[model samples]
Target: MVALTDEEKAMRDGRDGDAVAAAMDLLIRYADALGAEQLCETRNVAGTNTQPSPAKTKLFEEGGWSKAFSVISLDCDDDIEVPQMKVPTCQLQHGFGNDALGIMPYSERNIELQAGAESFYSSKGVNVLATCTPYQVGNLPTYGEHIAWMESSAVVYANSVLGARTNCEGGASTGSASITGRIPCWGNHLVENRYGTHLIESGLRMTGFQDWGMFGYFVGDMVQEARPVMIGDLGQPDLADLKHFGAAAASSGGVEMYHIPGRTPDAPTLEAAFGGAAPPESLHYGEAERRAIYDSLNSIGNSEDVDFVLIGCPHASLEQIGRVARALEGRTLSAGTELWVMTPRALRAVSDRNGWTATIERAGGRVLTDSCPAMSRVAPAGTKVFATDSAKQAHYLPAILGIEAWFGTTEECVEAAVTGRWRGSLAPAAVVR
Candidate 1:
């Protein structure tokens, strides 16, 4: 029932090319699955989670590039040449990093495979900027612009912070949308679906990234799928704070969008956020609730002996990298501890230019790019304990790596990285509201 333009119909009918036809067919099925009545043009920006793997390399080696493209991209049994993307598209974070800079522990074969994948995508007109925070780089989507992004944290950020429209696009859907320059018109694409269903009022004076992360964790858990308009007594948060907030919220729950009155682009006022409709219910998040959420996030018990301290779950910004460098300026990590700072290549370039990378490297830390430990799921050998400043990392690392994970402020994580011991307090001395 979805209406397609003449160009789209030609592609679907194999008039353009086999690859375009196959891609259009898949998109038609996708639109049908979504129960969408039509497809809309998307020219703002698009990103795909089309990362490389060893299995994909094997497929290419066995069946040639065309076969590999159809199998990996179109999910089809037949072979087809992959067409160039119609819109500005980039690759999201994958299991690849700059090996010369010791970004990640990749063997020679791993590096070669990663290079092959990158070359393939690059040849097909896809920018291979492999970072989750595409907005930090040159792939920013403006307010109200439609984007087909796949990463969860990036989806929340594009919607809640930048006011761009997108749902939690998956890898295949994003791939289709990128090639076709269109996605099914549903979910957050429609303005009527962007209203606030719940209201969250916070009592804490949020200051740092960790505080905002915990607040987001609490709200995401409480609100679940409901869109929330946050009305709280909070200080003005910067980009880093909102990044951590959106990352943590998307991690703990399925929150694609949120609203902060007078802060975010879409929500100039609460009434505007909800489209003049009253919120169904409101939840209060005070100091006690914050402490409780923090406790629940920490999976480690009394075993403070830490092995790794990680920072940058959504990949650190330039300002955040500077803070890390400043915190560990004169200090070195413990003999048995390691510190890994994950960030995007663009920001890493900035860090290198500003001497932050050298500062952290001199302090026994490595500034890694493209992937995090959780995504790669390969910690240093014999690592039993892990600590991080990201609530999202704290929630996922233990389950993914089966290790003791600790969550705290960036300062606390630095302290743990230096001493190989966790000495951070969970909450302040304020009474519960």
Candidate 2:
């Protein structure tokens, strides 16, 4: 059994009522299952609760929000009375909303169900910052802060890029953490496990956003859940580039943490990445490897006649929205083609003020928010083939939607959107001096 403090015991003894006790119960069980010595305190949590599903729908219909929370969130079958969250928590993206009437096949009753759940959860202090990239909006966790977060891409970004600590948590665990403010102190939460397990070196310059995604996919595939130490002829990558990279890595492999020495916060040097131990033999991500990864991501596609172009997966940064808008400013989408840019609603508002939203909309593209097509398994009606700049999306959409996917740069995707054909060709590799 995992050791619990007096305070934790008090919560379990029902000092804070049934919901918290149940949450505590779940946390203790979770900690023990992980072989964790104790539960660590956490103030940040991100999870999903509002996505409409047959199970949640039935639960809500039978016993309302409390029953749903007890069963779904707390993993308890008891109809416990839910209470306000004990710590700061936010809802992750829950899929396209009711506003997607003409565009998506999401049912009206399901939309209503989602709205009701969102209203109920918000009243209980769950911030409905409905975006996959919560860090992009607010809720940026401090380096080394223990957090309970869902979403594989966000978990990897928190650990590898922002230096925060989190495992790829699930709904029940994050829900439990939200109420009790405690999580299992195993995996990425510990300093010892944060050290690099694999070393990746690249002499080929990986500077562009596309290159970052490809390199991340390669690293993730090679490491396959192991922590990686990366040293390369990589140019200075910006926020969006790293965002794309981390998301791709998490999707291709279950990479929850990595160290880019001198770039990522945890590892300032090669030695530091390995905790003073000698680094492993470097795994090279050279031209052949990059090409192989690209082909793998694109292998699902056969038709050149593109029907949809999706621009964001971990949610687009403001600059990415602007880039799409700029590319589509004077052009209209092809007759049969549709384009969508997924971003945080907050960023979408910023994009609106910057006129990027207007530009893209005018060119027959949408600036969507609060959810992703992959999570919903919903795309434009009759979308058999899609193009995207996100390696993560390219990796997932094919499997989820049973659609062909073309992986390329944002410009190439936009061109595909405009012409309704996949004319994209990989650029000749450029070496960074």
User: Which ten-residue region of model 2 has the weakest summed lDDT?
Assistant: 424-433
Which residue runs of candidate 2 sit more than 4 Å off their true CA positions? none
Report the lDDT tens digits of candidate 1 across residue range 1-433: 7898888898789886777777778778988998888777786444543445666767877885556667666666676777877788888887755543343455556566667767877888888778889889888888999888888899999999999998887766667777778788888989999988899987777867888999999888988876888986677899889999988888888899999999999989999999998766678888778878888988464589999999988899898899899999989999899998889888999999999999999999888888887877767777899999999989898888889988998989999999999988775723324
lDDT of candidate model 2 versus the reference? 0.90
RMSD of each: 2.0, 1.0
Cα lDDT tens digits, model 2, 167-237, are: 99998999999999999999999999999999998877875999999999998999999998889768788
Q: What lDDT score belongs to each candidate, Candidate 1 first?
A: 0.82, 0.90
TM-score of each: 0.95, 0.98
